[model samples]
Target: MNIEIVDIVNKINVILVEEFEVDEDVIEAGKNLKDTLDLDSLDYVDLVVIIESNFGVKLVESDFANVITFQDFYNLIERKILAKQQ
Candidate 1:
């Protein structure tokens, strides 16, 4: 179940770019995800659905409370992916 951070980042970048129509340039590690993606509440649901489908990790609302930057989001995904392996 070992996964690279680069793989997580690449998958997320593609998901954001293709599913949310977010600009690829804005999807950086230190940038704010919500602000960069301009995601509304419904958009969050869509994001969750896409993430679940893509990563096979079921995400809850609280999972996003501390996810401000793309790095945080990537870390969360990594955690979830690893958690699922357990």
Candidate 2:
């Protein structure tokens, strides 16, 4: 499936808001996930599960090392989804 970045962002925002109890308004594309969302290691684990369950994309530790911002998260999911298609 060809997913748009905006859709990915929206889905991610919903997950964050519902799962993490994050405010929707704070979820911007450029914001850093750790700094902006105050996500810790456990939160990351939950996020990985959520992504895998929701998007059918498995993310490893290395995939998250460089993913600091929301856009990076979106790109990671987008890449994984596209890779799954191929």
Q: Which ranges of candidate 1 are over 4 A from the true structure? A: none
- In the range 1-86, model 1's lDDT, one tens digit per residue, is 67888998999899899988777988889999898899899999999999999899999999999999999999999999999889
Give the TM-score (vs. native) of candidate 1: 0.95
What CA RMSD would you report for each candidate?
A: 0.9, 0.9
| Model 2 ranges with Cα > 4 A deviation | none
- Per-candidate clash tally: 0, 0
- Write one digit per residue (lDDT tens) for candidate 2, span 1-86: 68887898889889999999989999887888899889888988998999899999889999988988899989999989889989
| Candidate models: Cα lDDT each | 0.92, 0.90
* Candidate 2 lDDT (Cα, 0 to 1): 0.90
Clashing pairs for model 1 are none
